[model samples]
Target: MSIWQDQHVTVVVSGGIASYKAIYLVRQLMKQGATVRVTMTAHATEFVTPLTFQTLTQQPVFSDEFTMQDPKHVGHVALADWTDLMIMVPATANLIAKVANGIADDAATTTILATTAPKYVVPAMNSHMYANPATQRNLAQLQTDGLQVLTPATGMLAEGYVGRGRMPEPDEIVDWLTQTLIDQQTDLPLHGKKVLVTAGGTREMIDPVRYISNRSSGKMGYAMATVARELGAEVTLISTPTALTQPAGVQYIEVLSAAELLTQVTAKFATTDMLVMAAAVSDYRPVKAVDQKIKKQPGQTGLTLELTETADILKQLAAQKTGQFVIGFAAETQHLLANAEKKLAEKKLDMLVANDVSQPGVGFNGDTNQVTLLTPNSTPVTTNLLSKTEIAHSVLTAAINRGA
Candidate 1:
């Protein structure tokens, strides 16, 4: 029901009679719109055939560490990268220890080691094995390393003697996985919403070589764009050239001057649900241009210059704002709130994010930022200095909560 639709989940099966439970796990995961793949340990294959799992998942089952089929490629890494989440249902005590350590003799172990995605382990073994000091230590280490471990349920086991080593039922595992995916989804709160973000400082060319531009490095704005995409928004980032890579999943439109950004923003205004005016646009441009790079004579110390007003894209967008939420950013040194409030109203914006650029380690090219979100209704919400990723989550959450 969420964006995990058609998401990839790899299920690793280990040696245990609880391996039968994986049949239903695959069924429930498929019912929830997930593309399921299975990998079995050598002993696990004794309980369930690779063909059986392949038939259930409608995908190939991988169980080999080395393959003569492709000597040049490692299938484990390929499977690892293909997975969004790696899950071990009926995780054996042996497998747990292997995962806790860096052992990678088996396909499952090797894939988990190579995979960068979030991993989860569903432990299923005998009560004695589950309570073993070694197992407990391994589990602790796995958790310390950020792995999600689902506790074994108390019930009957295949060995007929059990206290708390039974694998959780398939339905319950599905519910847990569903909740886990939902948590990941919230990181991108604006998912499915369209956002237009203008970033970086606009330059106004004075001559062939000389130009006027602000000290804005476009870091904050680029961070916002990265966060917006992470929060699931379809972001169109209109930016000036910077030493930053385009954020994945975001559509980037390069614009060197204020007029070009304005042109791109207007063209896509109707489709955007929110507009973040984070760009530091030049207020004016040279009224006249020279055919060649300006050269100073030995005695020349100054030159008279003429300037013309540049296009104000934020004001134009705010004026045409219908149901869209318009947010403007004020990077100020003094009278932050007063200037922010004034700009908020003058630009007809719904909200304004203000930051003290003069403060050290809080703005510009730095990776961290501290800012305040000012709403027209009340006082501003101050944010602590945080990594751009955290700030993006906070901003998107606030915007979504405001129903913007």
Candidate 2:
């Protein structure tokens, strides 16, 4: 069977010079056995006609909501329900902002806003426009909402400039979308296996207005999820609230505190094949959480607050392990290897990722990480600075090798 067999995809083309590429993407999806429906904005019609897309997709292109010719079939709601995956190729800045803000002024946006399916956005715009703070913020917000964002690459643009902002080629986009729809158990070394990945930093509430959290932004954990999906594992990510995009083919359970994390993890541990605890969970929380914001006293020299230890998530998970692969992360300053090895044995983890937070650009919120993969039986495998995506693939490979 094809990768996209029994799958339905909605390709939404926005207004841009890159709109023409959407047709090729549709054809590629069709080749992979996916049923595709096309939706285009008014300005998108300037470059390509509805007839052109209709002939390619073999489905009517939805342009306007009011143009529904039939009274019995609600077109917008029907299309929304039909879509299993939504990919917006050539997503312009205006379109990005609209989707980010939940604007549903047109057929494409309306269906997108209404659909409960996963959305993948491939942005294509001018280099400067792509890098604008407002656009970046919108992209981050979209990611935070669990939308998959494929970053624009650097290359020659239609505007005669060379930098980042070129839309990826149609075939590449198709491959990504195809991979996105494929079951995680197909052709993966870890096929028929279960994987648990934790990401972001938990927030420990002190008052209604304040909380304690670490510097972690959850990039590493998200990366691991992405890679694990690519390798054919059913992944469940326990994430703290963050702006990072959820990987395609992952089931995410969001938690705010260490206690919540413990509850979720323990509940899912029974059937899990491997557990990767990548979150920077808070070690302590305020003993008494103030229901209201704590008001500062005028004459107070310093505010004294009592704290209590949060649930030891990893240690507890380790105690109840049922021969499932367990992994942990050690973000340390001094005695890097020693600490990592200690954690590996003490927590009964199958492996631990040790990296010094003090090092520049190698820890939290950054794209690059230098990690040492510590195992119980052999020398640790250290890696140079690598993009989170690359590092994630390596880590998943290591885990699969070890587990197998």
The TM-scores, one per candidate, come to 0.59, 0.61
Q: By TM-score, who's the top model here?
A: 2
Query: How many times do residue backbones clash in model 1?
Result: 2
Off by over 4 Å in 2: 1-18, 21-176, 179-181
Q: How does each model score on lDDT?
A: 0.85, 0.87
Compared with the true structure, model 1 gives a TM-score of 0.59
lDDT tens digits, residue span 234-296, model 1:
788999999887765668999988888888999999999998888999999888767798888
As a whole number from 0 to 100, the lDDT of residue 119 in candidate 2 is 92
Error of model 2, residue 128, in angstroms: 37
